[model samples]
Target: MTFESHGVSAGCWTGTLQSDRRPASLSVTHRGAVVVQAALREAGPGVWAVSAGLPPSVIDNGVHSLLLVVGDSVLASLTLVAGTVAGDDLLAEVAQLRAELDLLKREFRRLATGG
Candidate 1:
């Protein structure tokens, strides 16, 4: 079995699961949290699209163990690293970079015009 870490958003995440066995059901459970039933859709043979929602408070920037259960057995167990869950820091950094780029553009224009 193979899985992809799709990052996190609003205490939820969407990822893809691939296995040789046709999945009957899908669910995710985080440590000390309730089991979240994932909404699964088959994308192709042995490929399942999944989305799981975690508890809001449980999404703080940290690593969490997420167990993927399919049918009556545990299919895959993995760790989800939550970084900038809301992406506030990332957005702020992007905005800062944009501002710096704008300043650099203005400086270049002034230099080229010799003004």
Candidate 2:
């Protein structure tokens, strides 16, 4: 079985799942817990349309990872970043990364302009 993500919209994640056999049970998990479960409907031969709602309880000021799973197998993942979830540590790390990136960009521009 293989799955192709169509991306998330309106707080729902969607994708096309292809399987030679019958469609399996689909569940959306977050933080090691099942958040949503939906039946996969046949879209075409060997194709299934998968959609699951992103639970509002999972939304908060932090990074959340949503997993599309069938049984024990994780087929896909979607990451959502909201406000400050990791506190100052993440902010500091991001600041450091941005500073390094700015330096790299400056160096790249200098080399490109032959300055």
Candidate 3:
């Protein structure tokens, strides 16, 4: 299996899977726990574009595995890093606060100037 994107963002991952033999089903897991059942779309002959979403319970930032299964056998396994860094999440919060502060500043200035 070849992945177009190696990272998971917004709880989802998109990639491509190539195989001579198509699997009956595909699934994703984190720390040996099943997280999502993935669906595949044929992009070309013997190639598929796959997308899967992470389960809400697996919230920690770390590496997770995707298991490609054909019947009872695991065809292949892929790894990915999960969750956003603390700094990134904090940056988003800071941007939101800045917007709110700007609005408050505008309101205060209007009141003080009586305009």
Candidate 4:
């Protein structure tokens, strides 16, 4: 239902999320790169607990987002949330898309250059 990261901090940070369905797994990232991916466990009716030792790739205090791909469709999504896969995963996905785009751009450049 709520996640709180207290004590001394020097990285990007955000907090708290409420989702409709429980997620089975979570992925974290910052600026579009896969950071942490871990299993989820139900903590309550609608709340799930994130495992400890989140990957270092997770942006601590960044504008992270997440996409929860459930069975066939995406069940939950979060943008501008703290963790990422749970909320940061979306950013990682976006990063993937960007990489694909860059590849396309390179191909176009090569063609234009008469290579």
TM-scores of the candidates in the order shown: 0.50, 0.70, 0.51, 0.33
Which ranges of candidate 3 are over 4 A from the true structure? 1-6, 61-115
Q: Across residues 1-115, which tens digit of lDDT does each residue of candidate 2 receive? A: 8889988798888999999876457899987899999567889999999888888987766766677998887788787778756667567646855896699799889999999
TM-score of 1: 0.50
In angstroms, the error of model 1 at 76 is 4.6
* Ranking, lDDT, top scorer first: 2, 1, 3, 4
Task: For residues 1-115, write the lDDT of model 1, one tens digit per residue.
Answer: 7777676666777888887775666777665345678887788999878788876655557555667776545555555556744566556645865896699799889999999
What TM-score does candidate 2 reach? 0.70
Evaluate residue 21 in candidate 4 and report its C-alpha lDDT on the 0 to 100 scale.
78
Put down candidate 4 lDDT per residue, 7-91, tens digits, no spaces. 1134323332345676555554434454445346665666665443334444355554544333333333444435433445666
Model 3 error, position 58 (Å): 1.5
* Candidate 2 ranges with C-alpha deviation above 4 Å: 84-115
Name the best candidate (by TM-score): 2
* Pairs that clash in candidate 2: none
Indicate whether candidate 3 or candidate 4 has the larger lDDT.
3
Residue pairs clashing in model 3 are none
* lDDT against true structure, model 1: 0.70
